[model samples]
Target: MIVRRCVGLLALPLLLGCCVVHAAPPRGFDVLHYSVALVPDIAAKRVQGQQTVRFKAEQALSTLTLDAGTLEVTSVTQHGRALAFAQAGQQLHITLATPLQRGASAELQIRYHGAPAFGLTFAPEREEVYTLFSTSQWMPSVDAPDERATLDLAVTLPPALLAAGTGRALPTRTLADGRIEHRWRLDTPMPGYVYGFAAGRYQQATQQHGPVQLRYLSVERSPAQLRTVFARTGDMLDFFAERAGLPYRGDYQQALVASTIGQEMAGLSLMSEAYGQDVLDDADQIALMAHEAAHHWWGNRVTCAGWEHFWLNEGMANFMTAAYLQQAQGEAAYQAQVDGWRTRLDALRAKGADHALVYADWDAPTADDRAVVYRKGAYVLHLLRGELGDAVFWRGLRAYTVANDGRSVVTADFQRAMETAAGHSLQPFFDEWVYTAGTAAQ
Candidate 1:
């Protein structure tokens, strides 16, 4: 069996007292970065875009950085006036002719055009491509999970293509020669990855779940197949609300793009077409959808303190989604699925890479580290739930969400909240799952 190694938690104990590691908490809502346009042509295998970012340095600093990837600048301007800038690798360096003090807002107008390979992940076997904005491309910001902010995007696309994104579309504008522009605004603050767009000829179907309206869009040819695949979205949402004690938020929507990636954002999710057709069907589909949907609470609302604790997001969402599926599908299926994942974890452990789960080692993570973060993280939550009991576990999760909404948190924060809900301390569990190098027996 092939297994992947985990990182982050395993290195914690060794580094104790060597250096203090703490992610900064949100001071206040500070910046408004507008992604004005994205234009991609698949046939050419390239993408180009521009951004109009407006930001305020809450405090004066000698050094500041924004998360940006490998991109080329065509032009730069400040407040409608031209400015000169330099680049050092992926960092875009701009100097103010005069020092700008704190509490000062500025508009940066940058025109960039590049082939953002990060946005387009291709799967050769399936002949599909997944597109999403990873900070490794054109734009820059504090490219960390702790820096959750709002985004307003207007995407321009060829007339033949349709797009699905996290925000609501205001209207579509037509350019002179037939290209179209779609304006979307996300009022709520979200992590950057959540606000992604996929453009293709797609079909959409809508349904209402209690107080929330839901929609599922997919490539047009597979409308019937998609309907069959995502049939349980409503039921899964209802199950999650009752079991997890948190309702699905915003305009709940999901779409299967012409790619092989699936992620949950605040109100919308993108699933790759192959994933939708292959792995997403029947009970498995419910489990995957529930996994993404629960992120509406775990990942979207209360984000991780930083990418280092991504397991905090992935683990909780995985466990909660499994919990919902258990309620809806029954214990045997849940246990079976858990065992299936446990097998994956065991393989990783045997390969000696299980230590990645407990170490904050994401500097240059390999594919193995990614698997550990997702699957092993889920196992950690499962162990925690076993110790806390069902009522305490669910109540603790609900309370955690209530206390930390619109904020990011770390292992200590989660433990404190859960301990309060359980009416007892959970230091042992945190230590074993988050700071130790080995997995607790499943």
Candidate 2:
């Protein structure tokens, strides 16, 4: 997500910058996969969907719950039989007909429909529909970054509209009602938040790199204009792959939508059309470009274990964006980005709003708080690079990504990787910058 930072004061302190205050994670079962079928009535701003949750129990269980946000679950079933269930506030409780023994697997089908108040967009005037964030708000599923699941999605929308989503596209089917069922299958497990789709009357183009397909979709940009704005995507992907030591996996899509905002999903990104125009007018408008594209490797793949260590996601992406800028643009562009981050922290510190990079809570985070995660997080990486030199730093990053690829990570895991690569302790550096709120040491 691309949010502009502002000035404000918020005082918070943490122990070693690693305490996170979220609800206790659901135990006893891990969601294995989600098979969903959805139909959206764009003109009415309403949608209905059937969601099937497959899970494996780690302990004996009679019931399970999912974070269901304002969705009216019509029924719950196992196999072909109806099961008892309840919808309380933001949770969906399903009672297993037979006690699910330890290690047993089960599937619960959730049929639902509602006009989502958020996380989904229905642009009738613009003739487009897309999802923004909080996957639970639109679909019933676990919304934890640590718990990942595969997805098989089938969306029924107007025949005239074009659509794109996570994973690879399957053959489309037209129903008797004349609506088309566009399907996608994501074999790799991913956090639910990044699983989404966008459909509209778009002018699009494709670029192929190896087995991965690169797609560009826009509501307004001509095919030539789309190329002009996002011309460097291939280079950016190549740069990230070389530095992280992990080839960018899966197909990638960039869709410029009707609003003025930027966000990313597992294999797709929704960028504002306004920003696309800005890029056409200015060549240096690459920060947002690099930032969002970097998420494929940083935030989405090598994920943070908890929100407290969120800097591992955004900070890494931000810093990698700077690195990409240095390679593609110049040394001055990279220094300018670092200096800009420093300036934000300086201003934030002047207001007494700065805190340790990791905090206990993110409930209603202020702009000053984001500066710590997005800027200071990136700043420390820049400092770490300076301390370890290019060889050790890049090696550490590769070691970390290769070891923890497709796994949740904490700051300690990162420090351990760097220490192993450096053949010494990095405790003092982390304590000063990451665990304590102070100026970045030269």
- For candidate 2, the 10 contiguous residues with the lowest summed lDDT are 2-11
Candidate 2 residue pairs in backbone clash: none
The list of candidate 2 runs beyond 4 A from truth reads 2-14, 17-26, 440-442
TM-score each candidate.
0.87, 0.94
Question: Model 1: which ten-residue window has the lowest total lDDT?
Answer: 1-10
**RMSD vs true structure, all candidates:** 4.1, 3.4
Give the Å error, residue 144, model 2.
Answer: 0.9
Q: Per-residue lDDT tens digits of candidate 2, residues 168-215?
A: 899999999998999999998888878899999999998887777889
C-alpha lDDT of all candidate models, in order:
0.65, 0.84
